[model samples]
Target: MDQAPPRVQLITSDVRQRAVLAGALLEAGFGVLSGPSLEQADLVVVDGALPPSELAAACAQAHAASLPVLMLATSTEAAREGIAAGADEYAIIPCSRQELELRARLALRHARARAPIVAGDLRIDPARHEATLAGRPLALTPTEFRLLSCLASNAGHVVGWQALLREAWQVEGSQGGRQMVKTSIYRLRRKVQRAAPAAVRILTIRGAGYLLAAGSAPPRPPTCR
Candidate 1:
């Protein structure tokens, strides 16, 4: 049997822009739903021009639902703002219809690729965007969850910096991308330490990339006589 077309929730206050985006997505074989409702939606496309508060709220709601977000921004700066606000990926406004379709498809593809990862005591559930080590939950942001997922998916292997950027941010050759990876990795390390020290380790492979290795469980304390 044929599968149903993916449903997309398009969020933009501008009627004209929403109409245009809806047209492009429909032409690309996607079902479009307007408004803030995320029900039955496979993906979300947001307008960066929305008030910062609105944009952030939209992205947060989508992520909370385990849905992927694609933001349409007016410029690179706006795109960065969208990403910082929790968008999974972005496209500059006034882009070609082809590019828009491609980006929407890419976002859906990435979202579908998320499968649970189990490396030793570390468990990552991409569907729920949750991670835990040694039965303790690790508080992680959306970006951090993506970064950890990428590393754990390739556990024990050196995953290059560019690979992390592409997997986590869905962008390649971005300026300051390396630094962004570094900063997020630092945060992930701290969280891991706090949750279950030595149960998992994200190691830097000097000029190579990062590696996610599951460490031996911590030693148990001696019992009182």
Candidate 2:
């Protein structure tokens, strides 16, 4: 069976920037759709200069339609605003070609990774899209679900802050200029802690990101390995 090229929708008003980005992506083998509309896109990238009203409207529409959104920012302020407006990811201006490609791939990868929360009794079933802690189901927001899923998938490895944001929030370095990812992480941690016991840890790596020990499951399973 033939595979379809990844679909990317770029919503930049700047013709030159759009042309450059679109051309680069197309050259690298992606199905590029450049426009201002958010409908019919697996990934939506919004320009930083988009008016607040327009940004909010587009975000609401995308969220309602369950489409993942990425924002392109020219400044830190713009990036913060984009995150607040509900963009799933954000890329910044003057991004390097390598960074752009990495971010694009990360966004697409995370998009595919998104699934329903399937967690129970310290077990998370990404395949089943279910999550549970202590034999009980958890009511995690989409963001929290992604955050936990990312941690679960990488088990023993320490996930970097930028990497976690990329995977969980789908936001690359472009839109994650300052505390956007941190704020999300804090919220995610708090939510998880609220539902779990103090001993069940979600360790912070200080200058790094987070870690979730695979066998850290409560009531350690005999066959945890």
Candidate 3:
């Protein structure tokens, strides 16, 4: 049997933005639903320009329904607010249509992967959009969680930057892909260190890529500096 295209419930107050986004998604082979109800939605895409109260209500409702949300925020602060309001992913407004489509697809992909991932002492629950280290919750944004999940899934192997971008952001050949991966990895490293020092290690393979391995002893300070 042929699978139906994933249905996206897109909500935005601005008619122009809604049309553009819906058209992009439709062109990308996704089914678009603009209705207020989420009865048949496989995912939800929201605009951050909506009044704060309304935005919160929409996200909360989606979260309660176990639907993954992708927010289009007008600014970085708006994006953070959306994430805090239960969105699983976000793209800043004025972004390319390709970026929007890719992010939406990424959210759907993450939502469909319900199995929990275990690497060393780190545990990633995709269905719940959560991760923990040594049983301590790691405060991670949606992007961070996805990045960690990718590295953990490929633990012990050098996961190239391009591969990480494709897995974490669902885009290929994007500009600044390497820098995006680098910045996210740096943040992930810090979070892991704070959560459970020496419990897990994300290693840089220099010229190759990155390796996530079970931690041994913490790295010693430079002997000659």
- In TM-score terms, which candidate is top? 1
What are the per-residue Cα lDDT tens digits for candidate 2 across 158-201?
A: 67777766776677766543376577767766766776765245
Each model's lDDT:
0.86, 0.68, 0.84
> Cα lDDT for residue 209, model 2?
66
Model 2 TM-score on a 0 to 1 scale:
0.51
lDDT of 3 at 19: 90
In candidate 1, what are the lDDT values of residues 1-225, reduced to their tens digit? 999999999998899988998998898899998556798899999999999999999999998898999999999999999999999889998998899988888887888777568988999987677899999998888899999998888777788889899988999858899999999999988998888877888888777788888885332222110
Candidate with the larger TM-score of 2 and 3: 3
Task: Give the residue spans of candidate 2 off by over 4 A.
Answer: 34-40, 117-225
Could you say which candidate leads in lDDT?
Answer: 1
What candidate 3 gets wrong by more than 4 Å, as runs, is 114-225
Tell me which of candidates 2 and 3 scores higher on lDDT: 3
Report how far residue 145 has shifted in candidate 1, in Å.
14
